[model samples]
Target: MKIAIVGTGQVAAALGKGWAARGHMVTFASREPGTERVQQLLADAGPNASAARVADAVGRSSIIVLAVPFTAVRERLEMAGDVGGKVLIDCTNPIAPGLRPMFDATTPGGATSGVEQIAVWAPRARLVKAFNTTGAENMAAPRYNGQPSTMFICGDDEVAKGATAQLAEELGFEVVDAGGLSAARHLENLALLWIHLARVNGMGRDIAFRLLRR
Candidate 1:
């Protein structure tokens, strides 16, 4: 399947490289028109991988992964044009600085849970929430450890979820069906727990979420 990654950052580059390793045709998109950074990043993605403007990238791909900073997500979507009728995967967790996940204390609602909010901007698009946790370094250099890193996904569309599951599996993660878009609230909150542990407890960047079944 054709995949378009809507960012040129570490997370986007890592996922794009992983997808290319899985033999999927992938493109990395950026807001800047003449981006040498994305061009250099695409070099790691191989010949099948290239960079394009966000709208053009979204228009050509079957799936779109938004891996930009959470703070920039809303405007990024707005600038990416109306991305309707596409499987838009939201990997953003609106984390601010010095605070918790959203980076702001006393925000009331869950922190870093901006996936659904972004989905509202693209009402006609099939939005799937995924890949918000874990540092980009871990994703790029996954240890595997004889177990799959749990990747929780939530969406209103089952078909879109299934497609995301396949992508997650290909990306070397064990997919967990976290139910509908409502589940995004918890996952977004989970980002805080992870951040707290990674930052306060010194758990390390290689740490990822997983569910233990008894």
Candidate 2:
């Protein structure tokens, strides 16, 4: 599968490396593809990976991962033209200044989640919310104590969610279908909880959530 990761952040690096390792062609989209950081990420991602302009990367891939900062979302989407009919994986948190949840404040009436806002921006693309609940460290290795950690995913499109779940499973995670796109509200809160635990509680990035059933 051809994948476009639209960020230089840790989530993009981790997932890009994972997919590239699995033999998928991974291209990281950057405004400055010639920079040392982008070049280093390309090198680290191995032979199957490369870097390209944001629009070019999104144009060439079937799966698009929006891994940019919350503030950069609209700008990145504008650069990624005509994403209709493509599977768009959202791995961002709407974190504002002072490390607060920005979605609630910005979204009118609090009726939609961040991922849903992405859907509004890219009306034709199939958007799925995943890879936001945990840090990139756990994303690189979604296993703890010999058990696969849980990754919560939600989307209105069943096929898109299935593909996202498969990708998460490929990265060694037990995927939990958290229902429709509205569930992203809870998922983002879950991510905020993780950030709080890692930053405030000092539980560190090694911690992850898992589901146990009898």
Candidate 3:
């Protein structure tokens, strides 16, 4: 799989290293193409990975990962041309800084979740929300505590979600179907709880999410 990560942040860097380790053709892209961080990632990724412009990276990749902040997501999407007809994975949590509140199930219009906004942006792209539930450090590791972590994914397109789940499983996570893309709001907020856990306790990224059932 040719995967292009459209950010230089921790999430993108982690995915780049992990996917490259999985033998995927991975590229890390940055708005500033010649930045030291992008150069370092290219060197770190070795021959299997390279640095590219956002549009070029999105064009070449079978899957494009939006790992940037929630506020910056739309701008980045616009920068990546014709993201339609590709598997677009969004790992964003629309978190307002210092807003220690919970997720509002209703949209500002009080109708639906905010994830639908992405749908409006890339009508042709098959968007799935995954990897947002887990920490950045955990992404690079294939396993945790001798067990596989569960990656919960959701999207309107079943085929796209299927592909996303397969990729998650290939990356060594137990993929759990979490219904439609609207569920992404809830999933994104799930991070708040996880972050709170990290704050209240001393849990690190080595800890992963697992859904235990009867």
Candidate 4:
């Protein structure tokens, strides 16, 4: 798969490396693709990874991962031109100043959830909610105690969810289908809980959630 990562940050770089290692071409969409920092980051992801302008990157890839900060997502999506038919994966969580939940302020009541709100920004794209619940360290290495950590994903489109699930599994996660786009509310809350546990409670970044069954 040719994956276009819509950010040059840690999360994007980590996922880019993982996907590149898995033999998927990764193109990082950035404002300054000619910069040394962006070039170095792409180089680290391997030879299959490169950098391009936001719109150009999205135009060239089948899968688009929005790994940018929540506040910048809308602007970035707008810059990506018409991304109507692409598999757009939302990997951002609404975190406001002072580590507060930005959803209350930014997300309208009728939007249902952040992912749904994001869908409005990119209405034509098949949006999938994923990769926002854990830290970048956990994203880079999802295994602990010889077991893979669970990655919960949800979307209105089953095909989009399936593609995101396969990508997550390829990166060493136990993918869990967390139902439709409405489930993004709970998933975002889970992300806040994870942030609290890792940062406030000092559980650290090595910890991850696991689902067990009989």
Candidate 5:
């Protein structure tokens, strides 16, 4: 699969490297594609990875990963142009200053989850909410004591969710289909909890969430 990751941050870097290692063509979408940072990122991601302008990358890939900061989501999506039938994986958390959850209470009908708002912004894209409830370190290596970490993903489109699940599995996560896109409300809150546990509670970034069943 070809993936266009729309960010140059830690989470983007981790996912890009993981997918590239799995033999997927990975293109990192960046504002500064020619920068040393981006060049180094491509080198770190191995031979299967490259960097390009956001629109160029999005235009060439079937899967587009929105790994930018929550504040930059709309801007990046606008840069991606018309994403009509492409699979769009959202890996961002609406985190405000002091680690507070930034839910929008005035979004037309009612309060909206970050991913739900994203759906409104890029309505044509096949959207899936994922990679938000864990740290970038976990994305890089999603194993804990020989067990794959849990990855909870939700989306209205089953095919999009399936694609997102496959990408998560490629990163060593045990994926749980958490119903439709509305379930992103819970998943985003879950991401806030993960952030609190890792940052505020002093548990550290090495910790990850898991779902065990019989």
Candidate 6:
């Protein structure tokens, strides 16, 4: 799969490296594609990975991962150009300065969730809420105690969700289908709890959410 990942941050690097290692053609979309930082990222991602301008990367890939900050969602989407008919995986949480959830305040359309706001920003794109409830370290190596950590994903488009699920699985995650995109409300809130536990409460970044069934 040709995956375009926007942003050069930890989450983007983790997902890009994981997918690249899995033999997927990973293109990191960046504002400074020619910078040394992006060059290092490409080197770290291996031969299957490359860097390009946001529009160029998005134009060439079928799957686009928005790994940028919550405040830069609209700007990044706009930079990607026409993303219609593409699977857009949203890996961001609407977090305020104090690590507080601020969906309504952050989103322009009064969206209840960050994914919903992303859908509003790029309405034509097939949006899936995923990779938001865990740290980037978990994304890089999801296994804990020899078991894969759960990755919760939700989207209105089943096909898009399936594609996103496959990517999550490729990263060693146990995917859980969390219903329609509206369910992102709970998922985003779940992200808050994760941040609280991992950062605020000093539970450490190694912790991850899991689901057990008999």
List, residue by residue over 141-204, the lDDT tens digit for candidate 3: 7577778888888998898898788778877888889998878777877777777677656775
Give residue 67's error in model 5 in angstroms. 0.8
TM-score of 3: 0.91
Per-model tally of clashing residue pairs: 3, 0, 0, 0, 0, 0
How many times do residue backbones clash in model 6?
A: 0
Model 1 lDDT tens row, 53-158: 8878888898999998777777777777767888999887876666455533344553325776676578888989988766787667655677777888898999
Q: Which ten residues in a row have the lowest lDDT in candidate 6?
A: 100-109
Error of 4 at 20 (Å): 0.5
Q: Candidates' TM-scores?
A: 0.90, 0.96, 0.91, 0.95, 0.96, 0.96
Better of 5 and 6 by lDDT: 6
- True lDDT of residue 107, candidate 4: 55
Q: Tell me the lDDT of candidate 5.
A: 0.92
In candidate 1, position 89 carries an lDDT of: 93
Candidate models: Cα lDDT each: 0.80, 0.91, 0.80, 0.90, 0.92, 0.93
Report the lDDT tens digits of candidate 6 across residue range 77-195: 88889999999999999887787667754456678888887888899999999999999999999999899999999999999999999999989999999999989989999999999
Candidate 5 backbone collisions, by pair: none
Against the true structure, candidate 6 reaches a TM-score of 0.96
How many Å off is the CA of 15 in candidate 6? Answer: 0.4
Q: State in Å the error of residue 14, model 2.
A: 0.3
The sequence of per-residue lDDT tens digits that candidate 4 reaches over residues 116-137 is: 8888888889999999988888
Tens digit per residue, CA lDDT, model 5, 20-46: 999999999999999999999998999
- Among residues 3 or more apart in sequence or in different chains, the pairs in candidate 3 whose N, CA or C atoms overlap within 3 Å are none
Runs of candidate 6 exceeding 4 Å displacement: 104-110
